[model samples]
Target chain A: MPPAALSVHLSIGQAYAWSVFKPPLESALGLSGTQSALPFQLGIVMLGLSAAFGGTLVERNGPRWAMTVALICFSSGFLLSSLGAATEQYWLIVLGYGFVGGIGLGIGYISPVSTLIKWFPDRPGMATGIAIMGFGGGALIASPWSAQMLESFGSDSSGIALAFLVHGLSYAVFMLLGVLLVRVPRSEKPVESAPSAFEGPQVSARNAVRTPQFWCLWVVLCMNVTAGIGILEKAAPMITDFFKGTSTPVSVSAAAGFVALLSAANMAGRIGWSSTSDLIGRKNIYRLYLGVGAVMYGLIALFGDSSKPLFILCALVILSFYGGGFATVPAYLKDLFGTYQVGAIHGRLLTAWSTAGVLGPLIVNWIADRQEEAGKSGSALYGLSFVIMIGLLVVGFVANELVRPVDVRHHIPAPREAADVGARQQPESA
Target chain B: MSEHDSSQSPPDRRPLIALAWVWVGAPLAYGLYELVQKATQLFTG
Candidate 1:
């Protein structure tokens, strides 16, 4: 199950590394920075929308079908974008990578989540962490691999097209391994001894959404993601800006290394913090992620520019919380709503991520851009944004505190009871 | 073979599991290598 999840996640997670293509696309297509961001932004929007809309379909069709569909849409998105690049048609790239490919990202993201939860009922957090860690690590492989490919192929339009083509074909074949291997557990076997309090009544996807716990969690995920993306979207530039006037100024190369370190932290936190959640309980784990996260942002806002190591340590911890927030959420949902229709519920919840996708980058970039215009330099450029992020994390912390078990009225009837009700309704057949 | 004989001689699943691990492990190894290479540049530069 982990491998199956990893295969799809590692491919779709390439979205994080989309910045690698920005410069090349800008130069080749004569586009502005905002224009280059259009496809990536649209892709994230599509990821949320498609996941929300396709959640029920995925639940009905099963993982194999969902995975196969994801493979087709994802690979074809790359292929179509390659054609767009080769022909120098910018709209096609948007349509292909952003719209069509985004559908793949949405469906693929939730494909293995429910299966792993069911398979490892004893350790739901750890199961999800294993899969989501791939999503965080995908950028690590892709950033350098794509850069090397662009270097080898030349940074021309033709080269970009070729790179896209290879990405499409390779990922298609790679994801097929998952498609062939994945399996739904035969039955929900009882755990020998359930340690957690989350073992409770099952809630339908429709009913799950109606609960207050769901909405509170939505706010939690949105604010947590927004804070993280603010840093991530500006990681490279922010580092350079922070130390611009120092004796040992940050080079572009070092900034790139900082991005790499953040990716490592992101990947590590997905697995490490989430596994810890299994032992510590989901709600307590999130307290650390949201509460400590705010403190990290505060530290950066106050003392970041004065010392390099302090800045890096704070940034790494903040990024870890970011990744932990994502990986931990599925298990948290399972705890609140039960494993029944978890994939669909997760899909619906991911709308928060799409909202954050736009909000996070916009807030940070807008503030930074305005600061630059006002003649602000160094850490002052990002000071306001960090303060705002601290506020967002505080809101997320309160939301996490508000979460509790679902009400009994919302739970679906037990299987035997449901069967009895079905028999009563269909007396002629009986 | 009879059903009993076939039941007694189950197909080996070790290789399939190993292949699945390989599918996951190979890419992870490559990614780690790339990260290490990038990290070295920070110090060496």
Candidate 2:
């Protein structure tokens, strides 16, 4: 019942690999990059929905059943997408990948998180980071492999269909690792010799929504994600557009590599950055994420067209932070709310992600499309979008600042038998 | 829990802040440079 490998596998197969299908899907459907990003957006939306609605189910059924359901939904989504691609039906791709698969993502994403925290109560931040790191890292492996398959299969409808079939079968096997391995801990005891200073305020799912803290964190996540994905979804075109008026141009193959590199950065951020949350505390770290992240975006907004190296460097840093924001947020929530219902609370909070999924791309793409129509070339079109991202990050920073310790009134008391928990702690203090 | 000093210390914040910066800075810089490089290549080439 060990939760480690299974969590990683499901994390990679379900969340990250879906992005691998974006390019081929776009090519086969003759859709633009923005249009192609729709599936990822929809899938992210579903991630929030499933997590919100299914957290209770996950708690009741345990990770085994939740992950099993995730495997089925996730794999079937690929199968269905395969069929859709073979038939040249774009809507099927939406339904299969975005809707059903997204549900799997939502469920699978949270399944291991709370369980890991329970198992490693002493290191809750690091534990959740270990599992969630897979979600970020998943894209790293999937993107290159997908690109290779597409190269071999020819980027046609049939090739794309085969890729989906392969993805379904492979992920089904991969996610099974988590389903088989994850185990709940036997004890509910706290791990620290002394309780963490920040541990007392246990907020329920219901109360969490009402607090200013929750809304602030929500804004922080939404803006962070929006900024990162806005660029991610449009990575290829945005890059290509940057130099349309210049003398040098990027080849399609190189653009694909650029995407791959971003995926690597995203993956690395999940593990490399988030685990650090255990030491620094989530709140202070987020200040940097929002504050410095906004500055990075501003640098790009102000001077991007003039200096290509500066632009790329700043974007990479921003995206790394973006990925780190995701990997670290669960730990942040754990800091604010005790582990009692962290998964459910996390699920509810994912609504921020769903909101960002839609708004980020809409802002970036719509503006870029308009600029293209207006005959704006080079980096001129992205000025407004980057500026908007800065504004959003500023809002998020304000929200993070608004976070405070949850009021004790918000805590739902435990059962009578557990009433002595307060007494046990009081005597220990004496 | 309420009796303990929950306020995070500078020692605690320093490492985490450093890690957060690495996470935030590395990817932000990398993604931007990569995108810009591609964009520039698109036009100049």
Candidate 3:
């Protein structure tokens, strides 16, 4: 089959590429693992912010404009990071990559989601997954490419600087492909004979915020993200640390490959697992994500350092589900609420991501740092963290269970003129 | 065509091209610098 939408694919690549920079950045800047991760963490934070604020703008002005802005910001961020590295200014790296580039990530990330959904209204889950799969898969390509670049460049401060520059430029050109190719579907009025799903009464954005389902989903996404990101942000070090007591300590190259492997799993989860949600329904898929995710954490906590394969397998599964959670949520929203303001709701819902972005890494890093200070080795330290993940997942599972069908009152009907749209499918049929 | 019409000239592509450079060229330049330096390091190392 032909490749998926270009914009969706590119955005995913851009987001996933951040991980490639993490290790070398840490080594070159003489930063700790947590410190090295801060840019990504903060970039995630800004992703929610920009997406939320710019969502309406995206809905009004269209994905093309939002994507254009994203290309500019994201590319500039790379250039800025390069400058920072060349000048030995860590703050600039954070500012450029985390803050500025993060905005690009947020905007670019959401740009394709709503647009893709509109194009494939019949298959919202699969469509969203197809787009989001890129975000997940982007890392797989980026990790190897980045590693190769670092290997070639010497892994020094200057080497990192060069990598940042190249990353900035290349991604900018690549992302521009999305900007150039993105086209809004023409607003064709439906014939009178056709029944319209979007033609019904509308729900205002203000009222949609008041519903319990919204808050329930908010909690669900927040907890799910926190669970997954805790593992992702610290994948390389966490894996090595978990295996520290093993007879065969993980080699640096091996650990990096492990990171790449986890990335592949993450990417694959976005497509394979999330696409499965379309068949099983969003709620059931989430049950698997949270319940299985919690179990995965438990397996880790209980089995610490005994079997490397088991540990890696569990972590990979958890990460995959984490990616699936992200990929599937947009479709979930479409299923619950109509697409009238899904983009807006999606933007609002991303606040959960921003919160998790901070909470996930903080919880993992803080616990790990404390454990290391206490001379806790291997599985012992992670036991408490995994327990916490379990609790979080349980909470998420409860939130998912709490999701009843969205109230009819919350539906944001199309504008009065467009109310009789015969082109769109009726919710009754859905 | 009138003298004024001839003098008016075609629309400037400079600003548009300049914008693309800032957006496009800047990132490429940075990436190239990094790639080149890294290539050199690999050779020397």
Measured by DockQ, the strongest candidate is 1
User: Could you tell me the lDDT of residue A323 within candidate 1?
Assistant: 92
Off by over 4 Å in 2: A1-41, A80-94, A147-163, A188-199, A243-254, A415-430, B1-45
- CAPRI tier for the interface of model 2: incorrect
Error of 3 at A304 (Å): 4.9
TM-score (chain B) for model 1?
A: 0.68
lDDT tens digits, residue span A1-430, model 1: 6788899998888988898999999999999999998888888898898888897777666777788888999899999999999999999999999999999999999988877776677788899999899887777778788999999998889999999999999999989977877665433233224432224667778998999999999999999899889888899899889989987678888887887788888888899999999899999999999999999999999989998888889888988888999999999998888766778899999999988988899999999999999998899999999999999999999999999889989887783344223222211210
Best by lDDT: 1
Query: How much TM-score does chain B earn in each model?
Result: 0.68, 0.53, 0.58
Q: How well is each residue in A5-114 modelled by candidate 2, as lDDT tens digits?
A: 33444344445555566666777688888778777778877888999989867755666677788889888988999999999999898899889888888888887776
Error of 3 at A382 (Å): 1.0
lDDT of each: 0.84, 0.71, 0.71
What fraction of the true Cα-Cα contacts (under 8 Å, chains A to B) does candidate 1 also have? 0.36
Cα RMSD for candidates in order = 4.8, 8.7, 9.5
Q: Candidate 3: lDDT of A158?
A: 91
Q: What shift in Å separates residue A288 of candidate 1 from its native position after superposition? A: 0.2
Worst 10 residues of 2 chain A by lDDT: A421-430
